[model samples]
Target: MKNIPKVTALCLSIVFISLSSISNAQQRYTDYDPIADFYNRFWSVPLERLAIGKLEKIMLPNLKPKAEILDLMCGTGHIAATLHKKGFRMTGLDGSAKMLEFAKKKIPNMKTILADARYFTTSKKFDAVICMSDGLNHIMKEEGLTKAFTQVYKALKSGGQFVFDMNWEERYIKGWNLRGLRVEYDNSEGIISSSYNKNTRIGSIKFWLYYPIDKAKNTWKRKAWELTQYCYTPQQIKKALQTAGFQTIKAYEANQDLGDARNAGRAYYVCKK
Candidate 1:
């Protein structure tokens, strides 16, 4: 029949579309099992206690005093609080309301908005933009990452810089092996959560959680979920920034300029719009 080939083509197209939709739907739901304050904090163990300090040392030396700064994906306003105290006009943005709840208390004077980095804009452009704590990894796809940098460019004044970080597959393989991956953090409040994720190189680490909401309660356990991403190399990051209209792109190792094992084993990006 004349329609036989057309029918077969339609069936194959439907199947392919269904499979692609399934994969995207899976990624849409992948996120951390929420605890009181832990998941959004992203197990601060990998970063030093002074993450804000290390990051500030990177930018503050070059930043003009009293400049307007935008903190993209500013979880809990950690660094923003410090920068605000230093007399910088700080505005923090993140998609997490749970984290923003904590941030409001920490930096009462700083402004915070709940918005994803890729789609947010402000009435005022900032002199510089920074996203910390591996915030860039959460973007997941190359298209979204490009959109994110483009948004940063739109939000920044000319000659402004956009800085962000993420895990490198190269470094993750070298150090993020499952054999020794465990994290425990808590304050003497009404909560405690300790958890670990087995290693997966393809995209993200599969993570689990055990959180106690109350000290009086015996157990608080939530099952695990996968956080997926297309990991980018240093070259890929620079290329994406360039595509997004960031003219001056640079990469840095975290602690030492040569490549700090903890922070810079992979790298962070500093781009000028």
Candidate 2:
């Protein structure tokens, strides 16, 4: 009896440790699978417009016609499809398979890769690399940000440009944290909640969505997910880019540079390798 009790305790401890490890792993990466459809349908358009406008001004002019471009962390493929229409060779890379499914559907001939920004490798170099819509913010650690920048640097040819956008404290506070919580669509409804920790410089958004499952029976299903982002100052981002071997860097406030009020608190960067 005494031995049985000790054995049970040890087994329970082992199970607890295993579960903790799994949870930590999950927390390290945000899984977009659950909300990929929603993002594709609703969230991709405005973000795509912002990225395309900035790219036209800062990236396209510097590249030759039909130049190769890598859309890093490309979600839903909206921007890639737009660029492809403009005669650019577009390659989309994203960590979420579900997100890439939409992209592939949009551009059947486009090359899409499912890989993490921090550790992706490419067989061919690109003339320009873009990580837009605050993609780099998803890399929650400074070391990871540096790793992603290094990967991007390696993926680009000499003299190639790397352009990206990021949100600072202003965006999180005024945009996400203070925005209305409820969103409604024809078939589904969502509630959004967000928080930012100044000390950790991390922001998180939790989404809860409800939709019809069995319309005849008046049944509904609910899905929930949370996403976390880290806010790095321009100085910190510039340091990371420099460490990754980018020499010339220019930063632009999107609201001032792009002339869009919706881009308030967003900053764009253009770097040359």
TM-score of each: 0.72, 0.84
lDDT, candidate 1, at 249:
77
Each model's C-alpha lDDT?
0.62, 0.80
Kindly provide the TM-score of model 1 when superposed on the true structure, using C-alpha atoms: 0.72
**Consecutive 10-residue window with the lowest summed lDDT within model 1:** 11-20
lDDT of candidate 2 over 73-116, digit per residue (tens): 89999999999999999999987789999999999999988777
lDDT of 2 at 255: 76
| Candidate 2 ranges with C-alpha deviation above 4 Å | 1-30, 178-180, 212-220
Q: List the residue pairs that clash in candidate 1.
A: 254-264
lDDT of 1 by residue, 17-76 (tens): 110112232232112224327654665334424456556656777888899999887776
Give model 1's clash tally: 1
Q: Model 1 lDDT vs. the true structure?
A: 0.62
Who wins the TM-score comparison? 2
Q: What is the C-alpha RMSD of each candidate to the true structure, in Å?
A: 12.8, 9.6
